[model samples]
Target: MKRCFTALIALTGAALPSASGQGHSALVQLQAHHSQADLEHMEEHAHYRYVGELLFYSSSFLVEEGGVERAATEQEVLGIDLHAHDGLRMVDQRIAVHDPLIDKHIILLSRNEFGALVLERLSPLDRDAFLANKRATMEQPSSKTQ
Candidate 1:
């Protein structure tokens, strides 16, 4: 009985999904193309979802929420921005209506008390790809062990 239980546990553990493993390779490929400045800019903004060429930022603000009643101080707003110049050409404008997670990021862009862009989320795939490529490039062959 103990042997059977152990086997079942092992099988279950093996079958469980690993969210990090599936998409990381593709993400690594994607990151190779971006520059450090581009990454820093994205990081400064709020969490964003990558849908094709656009990054959408969404946040709940203090504003009226419903009708007939007094406008609530809080409201939710979605903001969209174009990330790539090539991708921008495909869209009608540089900015558009915020659409929720069509890709990866969930938080989207967030604003401060003064209404300035403060945080942004990168797609996990994008991050993984970027870091992996960087690691690979930084690896060097050495003739002597130190």
Candidate 2:
């Protein structure tokens, strides 16, 4: 498993390989080659099936539930917490992330004293930008060692 990761990192970009593994990074990479509608449909379907859901996209989450539902603005969210949750034991294991057995990151963009703020924002990106960043990242050197 580690060897595979090493090879993938070597093949892709080396810089910030850790951050590149975050929830959003997957979407960015996929969207680089896919249509936005297809991406949305898949993520929404994944959420419905309790397979896997996107954690963040600039502001929008691939799926939303309970408290954290959407992309939040600075004023709308004072701070955020990324934790783990053990649901009904259904969410699929993504990229060898043995979530339920291990701890998964559950993101929270909490409300303020007034109430949850209605953020006026756009989706962090469309396919074009995602691909551009991905291309750039792939060209960078791996800075941190495994």
Q: Write the per-residue lDDT of candidate 2 for residues 32-115, one digit (tens) a residue.
A: 545766655644432211112222322221123353333333322122321232222233321111223213333333222101
- For model 1, residues 19-73, the per-residue Cα lDDT tens digits are 1221232223224545555543443431121211121212211122232212111
What value of lDDT does candidate 2 attain over all alpha carbons?
Answer: 0.30
In candidate 2, the residue pairs with backbone N, CA or C atoms under 3 Å apart (3 or more residues apart, or in different chains) clash, namely: 14-142, 15-142, 59-71, 83-106
**C-alpha lDDT of residue 102 in model 1:** 29
Q: Candidate 1, residue 97: CA error in Å? A: 30
Off by over 4 Å in 2: 1-80, 83-125, 142-146
Candidates' RMSD to native: 16.8, 17.4
TM-score to native of every candidate shown:
0.22, 0.21
